[model samples]
Structures are given as structure tokens and as C-alpha cells.
Target: MTTIAVVGGGISGLVAAYRLRTRLGPDARIVVLEESGRFGGKLRTVPIADGPVDVGAEAFIARRPEVPALLAELGLTDQVENPSSARPLIWAGGRLHPLPAGTLMGIPATSGSLAGLVDVDTVARIDAEPSVPLHWDRGADVSVAALVGSRFGEQVVRRSVDPLLGGVYSGLADTASVRATVPALAAALDAGATSLTEAVGRALPPPSDAPVFGTLRGGYGVLLDALAAASGAEFHAHTAGASLRRSGCRWEVDPVGEVDGVIVAVPADRAATLLAEAVPAAATQAGRIPLASSVVVALALPKEAALPDNSGILVATGEDLAAKAFTLSARKWPHLGAREVTLARASFGRFGDAAIVDADDDQLITLARADLATVSGVTDQPVAAVVQRWHGGLPQYRAGHLEIVAELEAAIAGVDGLEVAGAMLHGVGVPACVQSATTAATRLLATVAG
Candidate 1:
């Protein structure tokens, strides 16, 4: 019987095991090794108040077909829940402003889109951005701050771009790469767009009535449970220190024994350690990627607590607030809003500013409440609160991230019966992880079959 060992029991590893099971049949032996007791990685759900609340990733991009298709295949289509039509607000200049429309990840295509958010001078600079000659090399990469700040001014980068990038990447624009973080804009630039404004205009996705994001009604735990059951793989939790080596024609994963194939699906740093002996070149490239830590404080207030109608509030860079962003759960999701409690999540920490993540639970919760009160004036004490800290939770896609991934993948391809998959390779969202795992499994299967 064919045997396979999957290192890391996160969603990527779980999905890869499930795909291998479906393709290799029930007779095959699949083993999953996770150093942590839980399997979801950053996709965690905890009990807060009377229902499940996601302290980790709260939602997935609905436009990405990978998640929707996976849900359908797993009979989880009914679990999909969409947010309300309420928009989000940007907290800048000590006030809340409407989230600018017609922007690609907060990079406005036109000056008017950012009218109320930025100052008159910044807006004027954006308006005249097209007239300024841009010197973007076709395939060169730079930080989002450098790209957007040069073209639109520092106000645009701090007030407009940083908040959105912080929410998605857990990092500031200065650390994120234009090619990796905002590929559409990079593609437009590569296609010979004359100016940054023109590139943003071309990169902005067409208007669509479809919901931009969605989440499972029962929380991500439901999906994790489903994937675990469908995979039919033996799981070993709290199982760390496993090493990989070649055993002639097969691979030997210590403690898991010999297997026909192996998948290293951990974080970039962990993947580097695992692949050090088997694929040194790949390991070297993987080690170059860095990670960021973050903390999330979920607050459950009385149903009558008065909050803004907006979905959430993003803090601009240089804000005095301790929290970076807050998702008004009760105001954002209709299903969540119907509950008896008002829920809100305050997120703290960024790429370089993650020292705050190590704070004690009580201190973090206190800071969360203080920041929440400062932003929305909803000082009602939360009846229940939950704090979750993720160390090295998100991989920072720094400039030249694409080139690093390309070299890593190229090295892995030269090896046989071995593959790697995780958030470090392509995109970091759930959809991207799913796509990466599916591709890894398919390719590994092809190699093993040959």
C-alpha cells in the first residue's frame, strides 16, 4: 500500500491529505503530524458568549472560487454566510471617514475617491499624479510604501493604504511588496501603464454585486472538522521534532516511518528546517521569508450597546490608539448581528511592532476596551472577552518575495517524491492556501504515479 506523511496539520496539510486520499484511494496510508494540539493553525474559533467566534481569520474572499468550490464539494455550501451591505470606516486625523471606493486595496484610482480621507494638498497631489512621469521598471519590485508614497504622498500611504494593508498582512505598507501584496497593480504597471493612477485604474476590479467576503456560519472549526473527517488520515498531535530523509526510492519521515511521498506544509521557517537535509537549496530560500505576530481581543457586549453602523474601523498609521483595527461583528454580519450580544474584535500588533502581542491577557483586554471606547465611544463593559495571540502568525511578503518563491519552487521541483505547500509560497488567504495545497497534492501524485 502507498504511504504518505504530511508535516503540519494546518488547513494546507489537511487539504493535501484529503486530496491524496481521494486520488490514492482508501487503502493508502496517510499520516499527519502537527506540533500543536490543534489543527487549524491561524484559522481558530473559540466559544465567546453563546456562540462561536473566530479569533483568527474571520472571513475568506468569496470571489475566490477555490473556497466556494471546496465548500460545495464538502457539502458545506449551506454553511456559507455573507456580510451585510454596511461599509467600513477609516480612522484618520482623529476621526472616522468613509472607506474610499473605487480603490485597489486602498490605493485610490482617482483623487476624488479619497476626498474626505486625505488633506487638500494630498488630494491635489493625487489629482496631479498622472501628469508626473513615473519610472516603474517592467519587472522590478518595491515596497508598497515606496510605490504609493512616491506617487500619492505620505498621507495617502499612511491614511489610505496602511490601514487596509495592516488588516490583511498584519504589517505596514513600508514592509509589504507591491508585486506580492498588490499584484493587479503590478500587472498593470508591467503592461506599460503610464502612471500609478492609470495602473490603479486599470487594476481596480470591475463593479460586482457579489459579496466580497464570506465565513462559515458555524465558524472555521466546522470546516476543519469536515476536512479532518474526509481526509481519513491518522493524526498525531503535539508531535514535533520530526525530520525528513531519503530512504532509497522512498522518503523516511522520522517517527512516521517510510512513505512513498511527503509534503512539508508548515510555515516558511519550519519548512526550511524540515527540508534542510533533503533539499538544501529550497531550505535556504524558505529561510529568507520572515513572519509577523498579532493579537486579537474579542469583546461581547450587551445587545443594546450602541456602536456605529459601519462594518469595521481601520486605524491609520501614526494613530495614538493601541489597537490597529476593530471588526464590529454584530454590525458586519447579519447572522452575527441577530445574536443577543454585540460582538467586536480589536486587533493589535504589526510586523515590527509585535512586542504588544506578548502582553498578559488582562492587560491586553484592558487595552482593547480602552481603544474601543476611544474609537466608537461604546464604553459599555463587555460581558465576556477572549484574547488570542499568534506568534509568527503571518508571513511578511517583503519586496522580491515573488523571486524568492520562484527560486524555492524551482529547487523543490528538482527533487522527487517530495513537495511543499503553505501560506509562504503564493497568497496567505484561505483560498490561496487551498489552491497551493491542491496543486501540491496533484503534482506529488503525478510524480509518485510515474
Candidate 2:
């Protein structure tokens, strides 16, 4: 009988197990080992005010085919829900400004787009940016702050870029790599776009009528449950300290025993430990990647609590606020809005500044409410609240990240019966994780089935 072991029961691990089961038949033994007490890693959903609310990832890039296709395969097409037309606001300079348009991930294509968000001198500098000669070494990577701060000034980096990047990676532009975080902008620079302004203009995706994001109506829990059931794999929750060692042509997974194939899908650090004995080179490269911790405070307020008409509020770097951002859930999602309670989420902590994530639930919730009141003037006390702390929630894509990923992947590819998939490699979004898992499963199948 063909047997396979999947380490870590996160979305990546579960997806790989599911893909393996669909191909390897009912007789195959698929073992899923999760160190945590639960299956979902960073993608968790909990009950709040008698309804399921996603405390981790709330949505996926709708344009990405991986998630939508996965939904179809799992017969979860009806669970899909799109956000409302309400846009988001950026809180900067002690006020809320409309999120700049004509920009690629907050790197404005023109100064006009960031008029109110930045100062006059900063705007003038941006206006004059096109005339300035850029010195981008082709294929060389630098921090997003280094590139944008040099051309557009620190104001753009703090006010615009940091907020967007912080929301996505729980990181700031100072540490995020331009190539890995915003590849299209880097590609434009590599292709000799002449200046930062030109590169942003060239990299800005064409406007599309389709929604940019989507989420499951009952929260990501619905999808996770469906995947768990359809995979039909033996799940070992709260199982830890599993190690991998080469066993002839197969692989030996501690606690799970020997298996035809294995997929290590935990965080970078955990993955490093598991692969240390079997593939030292891969472990070395994986260990170099760092992770950021964060806290999410979900509040269920009375329906009368007034929030801004916008979808959410993003706080600029250095803002006098404990929370980095807030998702006015009721305003953002139409289905969430229809509920009896007005739901909102306050996100706290960022890379290199995660000490606040360790705060007590009451303290975090207090800060969340105070920040919400300051931003939207909704001071009403919450009817119900939940705090979720994700230690090592997101992996940082620092400068030269792609190179590290390349080296790690190369080392893993040389070893038979071993594969890896997670947020540490490639993009950090759910769609990217799905793609990585699918690729790993396909490659592992090719090696084991032959």
C-alpha cells in the first residue's frame, strides 16, 4: 500500500494531502500531523456573536484561479462571498485620506494620486521624480523603503507603502523586498523604465471590473471543514517533535513511521528543524527566513454603532495608534453587514514590534476599542469580542528573499521522496499557498508513483 506523510495541517499541508488522496486511491494511507491542537494554522475561524468570523485570513485574491478552482473541487462554490463596493481609507497625518489610486501596491504612479496623503514638498518631489535619473541595477533587489524612500521620499514610504505592506505581510516597507513583494514594479525597473514614476506607471495593473477579493460566507472554517472531510486522511492533531530522515528510497517520519513520500508544510523555522537531518542545505536556507507575530481583536458591536462608510481603515507607520488597521467587517462585506451585529476587526503588531501581541486579551481589546473610537468615533462598548494571537503569523520577505527561496528549493529538489510547501516560499497569500501545495503534490506524485 502506498503511504504518504504530511507535516503540518495548515492549508498547505491539507491541500497537499487532499490532492494526494484524489490521485492515490482509497487504499493509500495519508497521514496529516499538526503540532497545534487544531488543524487550521493561520487560517482559523471562530464563533463571534452566534456567527462564524474569520480571525486569521479573511479573503483571497479573487482573480487567482487556485482558490476558486479549489472551491469548485470541494463543492463549496455557494460559500463564496464578495466584498461590497465600499473603498478603504488611509489614516495619515492625524486624518483619514482616500486610498490613493493609479498606484501599484501604494507606490503612486503620479503625485496627483497622493495629493492629500503627503505634504506639498513631498508632492513636488514626486512630480520631479520622472526627470531624475534612476540607478537600478538590473535584477538586484533592495528593500521597498530604500527604493521608494530615495525617489519619492520617506513620506511616501511611511504614509502609503507601509500601510498596505503591513496589512499583507504584517511588515513594513523598510524590511520588505521590492522584487518579492511587488514583482511587477521590480520587473519594470529591470526593463529600464527610466525612473520610479515610470516604473510604477508601467507596473500598475489594468483596471478590471471584477472584484479583487472574496471570502467564504461562513468564514474560512467552511472551506477548511470541507477539505478535512474530502481528504479522508488520518489526522494526528497536537502531535509535535516529528523529524524526517532518509530511508533508502522512501522517507522515515518520526511518530508517523516510514512513508513513500512526505511534504513539510509548516512555518519556515519549524520546516527548518524537520528538514535539518535529511536535507541540511535546505534547512540552512529555510532557517534564514524570519516570521512576524500579530494580534486580531474581533468586536461585535450593536448595529447602531456607526463606522465610516468606507470598507476599512489603514493606519500609516508612526501613527499614534495601537492598532495598525481595522476591517469594518459590516461595511466591507455585504453578508456580514446584514447580520444583527456590526462586526469589526482591529489588527495589532508588525514585524520587529510584536511585543504587544503578548498583551492580555483585555488590554488588547481595550486598545482596539480606543483606536476604533479615535479613528471612527464609534465609542460604543462591544456586545461580544474575541482576541486571537498568531505567533509567527507571517513570514518576512526581506531583501534577497527570492534568492533564499531558490536555494532552498534547489536543495529539496535533489532529494527524492521529500517536498516542501508553505508561505515562506513564493507569495504569502492563500492563493499562493494553494499553488505551492499543488506543485509540491504533483512533483511528489511523479517521483513516488513512478
* lDDT computed for candidate 2: 0.94
| Cα error of candidate 2 at position 109, Å | 0.3
- Candidate 2 has which clashing residue pairs, if any? none
At residue 94, what lDDT does model 1 achieve? Answer: 95
The segments of candidate 1 whose C-alpha lies over 4 angstroms from its true place after superposition are: none
lDDT of 2 by residue, 165-202 (tens): 99999999988999999999999999889999999989
Cα deviation of 258, candidate 2, in Å: 0.9
Candidate 1 worst ten-residue window by lDDT: 240-249
Give the distance in Å from residue 54's predicted Cα in candidate 2 to where it truly belongs. 0.4
Whole-model lDDT per candidate? 0.93, 0.94
